[model samples]
Target: MKKIKIIILFTILLLPKLVFASNATIAITGVNTAAVGNNIKMYVTLSSSAAIGSWELTLNYDSSFLKLIGSDADNGGTFMANKVAGASGINKKVYTFTFRTLKAGNTLLSIGSSSLYDFDTMGEMTVRTYNKNLKIMTQQEIEASYSKDNYLKSLSVDEFEINPVFNKDTLEYSVEVPENTKTINIKAVANDNRSTIDGLGEKEVVVGNNKLNIVVRAQNGSERIYILNVNVIDKNPIEIIIDNVTYHLVKYKEYLTIPSGFEETTIKMSDIDIPAFYNKKINYTLVGLKDEAGNIYLYKYEKNKYERFLELKLGNLKLTPLSIGNKVLNYEKETIDFDGKIDVYKIDKRFKLINAKNILNGEEGLYLLDIVDKTAVKYDLKDIYTLRKLNKIYLATTIIFLSTTALSIIIMLSFKRKPKIKDKEQKVKEKTKKELPKDEKVVKENKKNK
Candidate 1:
């Protein structure tokens, strides 16, 4: 009967102490598994039966296997050695910590000396701590369970509908938008959570057809592509003609930048408004022209005149010559080798063929303009013409001298063939003797002897 009375007395004395024990809890929650080099996030949550006014704790983790990069504790500041208060009337608080996995290893996240205070009384309360275990694996180890699903579960565009609806097996879709639309938003959800999708989000569109592609990469190293053929309508288009071929003005002017010393303006072409840039000092206007083959080129425009704009740079010298026609100068393009191809131009057929000319000094002549190398070499046309003339004069002079010498030799031979004065007198005497016969011959011989 005495032992029973002592047991009753002991139970009655311990009942109040058991009732005063804390009902607060603190636990860490996150993905327990991560691949090396990847980032992982963990949350530290604190809850209590009573409102939590404030709390302080030290988070501990292995620095070798993980590196803490960021945290959302204490208002984005470092959570170490700091006391933070919960929001008003809130009994629960969650803090996030981001870490980058370093290598293949296991790590634990625990807290130390954590004290929770009551919201009303500000009295410290006892709390239970729960640690979390994280396992980091190598890339090869994680690949064993990789899923091979490289397809999208759903595809959509913001404020636009895809034609023929969206199907996982259908890789191509066509969407049409108004000409004024500048951008389109794309949303693609992967079929599997392990798959990654690229080429999503907002993309700029042009006035014509725009081709966009989305690529899905499965965890097991496989890929699938989805194409979007987006066509933008052109309303009130501006058209122009060049070289007897028709072209349209580029409606999207955001891509082009106005040149220095030029102001934005608009011009009328084919009775339609066209955007252009103009400079009053130079009286030059530039516009973007698009060919039928979907190629864009800048053109110089004037009063009812248009030509392809060409600018050449050679070292410190820059030249903006008059309209150089597409017809290449065929007279002597290959005469002087510029070590590569040369663009020879003739402003007019009646003038000399030239590659470049100094507009400032009026030094107009032939030059080997190497556009790729940005080099120029001048050729002296005057010297070449002078040498040609000298050669012709030399040939003519030699011909005249040879003809005069041959004429003099012919005249001298004719004079030498004629008889001299003594030979003429001897010939006359002989003739007379033959005429006188034998009697006259004897009388002449006796007289010569005397």
Candidate 2:
């Protein structure tokens, strides 16, 4: 009797702890100290020796001191970490609550409500939570400094804005400048207070790239470099000198005058006829012209004729000279025109063939053409005899066929069959039920008999 009384008393005393131990718990697990507007994460975990099927957690914070930003299950992940469980229950599952300090004050982060279920899927016990207090401090003000902050804040020249570019957290700066600007005055400033910046003045730029180095020295003698990747693009390249003589480049409105000896690049030209007609001094563009020989010429249009503009040696090209006189001008620099006295010109490779074909339709005519494209040129001569004979034969055949058709039509019209006079055959009109319904003596449908 004495041992039974002692055992019952012990069971009664240990019943509360055993029951409370299985109850769910909640806590704010983050840094105790926080700055103003700093965010803190709080965890509310419900754990029981039994398996958990599902749960819902809720937190209430002091609205005056802290502002609740967000609440999530395991920081925006799924509620269940390993959905397929090997064991019967989850060991620990956390519910996250994020809050930001609104004012520099202490706030109590408490679990206002929570519910949990075991593997049996029943909420039988009351849930308990541990409350937490957060100490939030005022935010520290950022001090203005020369070296510590953003380097190369503002880069500019007189009346011109130079965009200084740098990689994130990089100390170097690079900029591109106009070509016409020979000397540029750059203004640069540092954000750090104690730092001193050197080489922030006038810099002479070369034709291509001009590299300028700026040194930033802080008060502690810590040196940093703000490299100026200054790219001074070369100006519109005007004159190019060959040997000692500098050939001045003359610019017209559209095209450019290519130098005689050297090569040049300019806007593409079209519409103008090559092998110009006469030496009429037209106020044409002072641009250059190129021939088949790859010779670029710049000359006054008044002194320029079709062939006299440039001396092109058509090496493999078949060119027919306009005149083949006794002079026999071999390796000629000046090109001759079609002879007006004799109207006869020799054909060499295949230039200016007077009777070239318009290969599209086989019509022969004179057409200026690009040597690279020879589709329009005549490759085979047309057979005139065969064409004429074929035409005569076709005309005779057509005339004979038409005559025979006309005779046949006339004979058929004359021997046509005359219609017999018994053509008035009449069709009978049948009376319907409406016409017969007036009288009672009418045949009825035999539906009943059938």
Candidate 3:
């Protein structure tokens, strides 16, 4: 009994020494806080002063809040994997594991009973132990593709109405496109920050039905869908695009009225006139072109003709055409008749004669009329001025009259001074010829002095 007591005391001291002097240790290391829905890494290090043969450890964690992804048996480069035991073992061996945070909570992870076979000792060695904690947070959920926020079409024209199909708690809908639409645009919206969307947006509208599918993803990795069926109708068969503006052609259409641009002006539509025979017997097709600056041009074509016979540059024209047997049209109280041989055209706002700006633009309103059928032009505007032709003749007559009048005034002054001058000259000559004119010379001198 005394010997047993001595051995027991010695055993206690030996155990303390062994634990303190150990050259091998194991620790549980991982993130203390993990965000919800995020991945985390856990590590276990087996460090020894010397090489080891093998090691095995079982980690325990709260399974409710954490999901284990996988582990690297070989520590990704630090240790050798034990294939038979399905573990890692080596000097300085490290094991790494990945996990996902399932919910918002706190959890503890610890290393269970483990062993390390040391090559130098050729036996199992003891090592230290540790525990770790983790936490997950709750965040707002993601949302996508709200049915109330998604729209398949947006148009401003009042001619078409938008009425989607009504269903029982379903987001699917449909819309009808107006006829003669060459192109169309669509709009779709995602209403949540955490949501994602794909497979839906603006798309071209074909002549038939167009299918629209929009996918929405939430923060929780859930998906929803919004489907739209758009029906596009067939438009007028004869359509044309000029300067980005579209015009429709109608049957038996002779003249297209271009509304006046100015709100108030003295120019009345009846004030303008086109010849009755302009479009009497021939067919006429009319189309309009608009530029970015708001200038409108009308292209006139003969019936059954593809090419344009006339293009109005500016302003507009009004032609009250009289058809065959049709009453003579009244224009400014003037009688006119349509021979039914050619169609008469009336321009509204784009008449170059009414709008002088067309002249600056180098545009002629009657250019089309000149090229079509060699039709004769009755009259045109001529500039007027006063005395333009008689200016040179008037200037010459004035110069000749002024010269003759000056000569007559000079002759009259010379005749009035001639008598006095001749009397004085005769006295001087008689006194110079006679020597006994001393007294007369003195008297002449006195007269001259006076």
Clashes of 1: 0
Cα RMSD for candidate 1?
20.2
TM-score of every prediction relative to native: 0.45, 0.25, 0.25
- Please give the lDDT score for candidate 2: 0.50
Best by lDDT: 1
lDDT of each: 0.74, 0.50, 0.50
Identify the superior model by lDDT, candidate 1 or candidate 2: 1
In order of listing, the candidates' clash counts read 0, 9, 26
lDDT of 3: 0.50
Off by over 4 Å in 1: 1-18, 29-31, 34-129, 142-150, 180-204, 214-225, 235-248, 251-256, 263-273, 278-285, 290-297, 300-450
Sorting all predicted structures by TM-score, with the top scorer first, yields 1, 3, 2
lDDT per residue as tens, model 2, 211-309? 666776765557767666665564443333434433323233123333223233333224323232221122222344332221234533333222222
| Model 3 misplaced stretches (Cα beyond 4 Å) | 1-22, 74-89, 140-450
Once model 3 is optimally superposed onto the true structure by TM-score, how far is the C-alpha of residue 159 displaced, in angstroms?
75
User: Which scores better on TM-score, 1 or 3?
Assistant: 1
